[model samples]
Target: MERGLTNRKEVAKLAGVSEATVSRVLNGIGPMKETTRERVLQAARQLNYELNAVASSFARGRSGNLGVVLPHVPKVHLFSTYYFSELLGGIGEAVHAKGYGLLLLFRDPSEAYDYVSLYRTQRVDACIILGSSAIDTERDAVHRLAEERLPYCVMDQRFDHPQLNIVAADHEQGSYEAVKHLIDKGCRHIGFLNGSPQYSNSGDRLTGYRRALSEAGIPWDEAAVYEGNYSRTSGKKAAALVYRDLERLDGIFVGNDRMAIGLMQGLRELGCRLPEDLKVVAYDNSDAASFTEPPLTTVKVPFYDMGKLAAERLLRVLADKASDPCPQIKEKLPTELVIRKSSGN
Candidate 1:
């Protein structure tokens, strides 16, 4: 298994698969079993095989562009949103430094699109998916990409498939810290406003919220928990429901800054004072967190770093640079709590 002496046949033999299978596995080809993929990659790493070299010799031509698939939500300017913008900023930087083009793709969740066709047609060298949700269609699409053996990674979302690569923030811990911060501020009756449960992070937040409450000797009350779509408007609309619980709920943990901002506005119009009437803390330390009425306290997720790390590693692997170790596909970064006046700090 000498680095210079290694060949495709040797890799296939060691992996106990065919040479063609090795080629498909290395180049990101399609519709294969997870066991086959694991075997090929493990053999490749073991034999010190040049994955990109074999890919170039056997795979289709490179498109010199990295495709970023984004979920298309109606009337929502994704670029205007701090979450997408920061993540893209990091991806753009990595793609540019590598002298590659960045292709922004939009897909409506209701519709179906073949992600592999982008590779088959030579449109993108690799892919990084954004706004992915916990859906069967999404699972199928990424699974197709893995079956095809193409280099790709998912951001801020989780899938049950073991072969799929993921880069995400420590959301559960972020949620826990936000709730704990409120508890430490002496708020006995804490409320939680979480996003829809379609995404795993929503569930993570709920788990963290419950954990903090349980640890603090507070009973878990379903009446105090509300749900929003992680949108400003949804937050505003939820204010009425949250308002009703004001007598018993003294402090609240919001899912994101946008929702917190909207909730604060709705509360003010409904005759509630800021910080004094209701202490608040939110997730995603977006730019507007500071500009809010009382300056919002929130959790800081390393989105930019998440994007950069995923893109950089995938691109480097695509270049067949054996100097860097084989790809570490799944990663979760830490989150920090930024204390501010909104949390009564």
Candidate 2:
């Protein structure tokens, strides 16, 4: 056997621990009891073990890799979507420029969120999370990470954790401006089509919609609010409800471009004309938004910038913790309302 390998095995045997434990103790991966760490070190000394440069670096608890945790939805091509593509582009740019490796980790929303395992296993030094919601399991996982003080950031998600570093867009302001724009265009009875209830941004949009109606002196109608899963199919399904209330509604504020596109298509198929019958505004300002029959008046969110900022901030801390040891950054970037023919502008 090679001398280094023999020394490693001997040290593990002398310490009465597995070889994996000896490797972890030497590499500083995960959490280890002080007694176990001491025993491993004493065994290494007895065997006259010497660590190479790479092993020494690992022993210091840094893997020279930045991890990005993504939601693993079956059959969902995340890279093709504008939201995911833009965010990944930004994150990729930051990691590349920083001379650090980018590690992709996928987690099923249905399964347990074990983000700390990546840190403990020495797979990555820091990480960024995407597609998180208000799920209780997610919240508990984040709380555990917070307690550990692991370097990580969550993009475009809001949690109850006070110590979490989050970079998210101002969806409330965006939704408010969308509805307010419709109101300014003489829409007295406007309807709002929102995304899933699981997302925090969904609540923010609803709050904005209500605020706009209250400020405009328009009576809130329970039927005016519609729900969708942020998919074009849901938007198409919502068209039936919108058609039923077509006579009462003069405008609609949609949560996203995909849903808005579907709603418009379904309404058009049912002989409802855009702007002529109902003015509409949407969010996300996706690439297809501009190509709609009547170009969509949508809210443009800074998702790319949000991803970039989150990565840069977290990487900066990893590079120099002494400068900014505890990064409790909470930022909300502004969203812009783009005017187009759909809003009757």
Candidate 3:
């Protein structure tokens, strides 16, 4: 047994095993006999030998890092929003459990960013892209990733390309269920406060709203729809817009809980009674949804679950890259409608 805990040679000598065996056990790379594994582990414990993760990754021709790319919006707190926060939490949990490092990278949607270079530069073994909007630059980047056959997954965005991998919530179904709930309550005049169309989910949600109206044999009123930026301030503004048709507006379906909360507050200030005069249903079912004055009736999109699935799917792609060069995966998790006081149900 060597006195200093410097190299694998010392551990191997103490364990009476080859240095190759020590490397295998330490790096967790190859399958080994249980008794040999225990012997190597025991020797490492005695010598306090710590594996050098960076060196091991290089030796195996890997970066040992999973990259998460988020849109870079200046001065806007990304984590403050429930969508980004929950998605990140899920990705972090999965990456940590996989014993791989997470490397975060931000790309400005206004500018061109190379998504494929992360794998090319050996910065990451695989990547997951979040907050992909309908911006041309962002779309170009995602397309480049797919064209390059990179091992990556895009969360909450659907490119529909056979080469692209996606994990997202069924936002259209969620929106349909919400609006149908309102219609079942005998509300014919419903207003939709929607997020920006730059997000694919926004379009999907709109599709759902229209589908519900069509199914109910109700005419779609373009005048009652307002575009919000999925922010509290925009939601407040949306409430004022809806007020113009206050007499006709019997129910409202908001795109997200953040906007819904703001809209609710603004409507209250405008002297409108909730659920009695105007019922509301929102999406995201965030933590704040339940604590609102009348509680929120919301569509629960599983952002956390989507994130976890994206991360795990990216890992699977990386693991099978050698044999299966290009893997196409598109997974849509189901959403649930949570009924509460806001919906008058």
Model 2 residue 62 CA deviation (Å) reads 2.4
TM-score, model 1 to reference: 0.82
> Candidate 1, residue 84: CA error in Å?
0.6
Q: Which is the better candidate, 2 or 3, if ranked by TM-score?
A: 3
List the candidate numbers ranked by TM-score, top first.
3, 2, 1
lDDT of 2 by residue, 1-345 (tens): 124667678989999999877876775555678899789888887767764522454455666688999899988787777788888888888988976788999998977789989988888888989888888888888888877777888888888877887889999989999999998999998999999998899999999999999998988997899999888889999999999999999999999998999999999999998989999999998889899999999999988888888889887886553543456768899999999999987
TM-score of each model, paired residue for residue: 0.82, 0.83, 0.84
lDDT per residue for candidate 1 within 147-252, as digits (tens), equals 6557889898888776778899999989998999999999889999999898989999999999999999999999898999999999999999999989998899
CA shift of 102, model 3, Å: 1.6
RMSD for each of the candidates = 9.5, 7.9, 7.0
The candidate maximizing TM-score is 3
Q: Which pairs of residues clash in candidate 2, taking residues 3 or more apart in a chain or in different chains?
A: 27-59, 30-120
User: Please, what is the whole-model Cα lDDT of each candidate in the order they appear?
Assistant: 0.85, 0.85, 0.85
List ranges where model 3 is wrong by over 4 Å: 1-60
TM-score of 3: 0.84
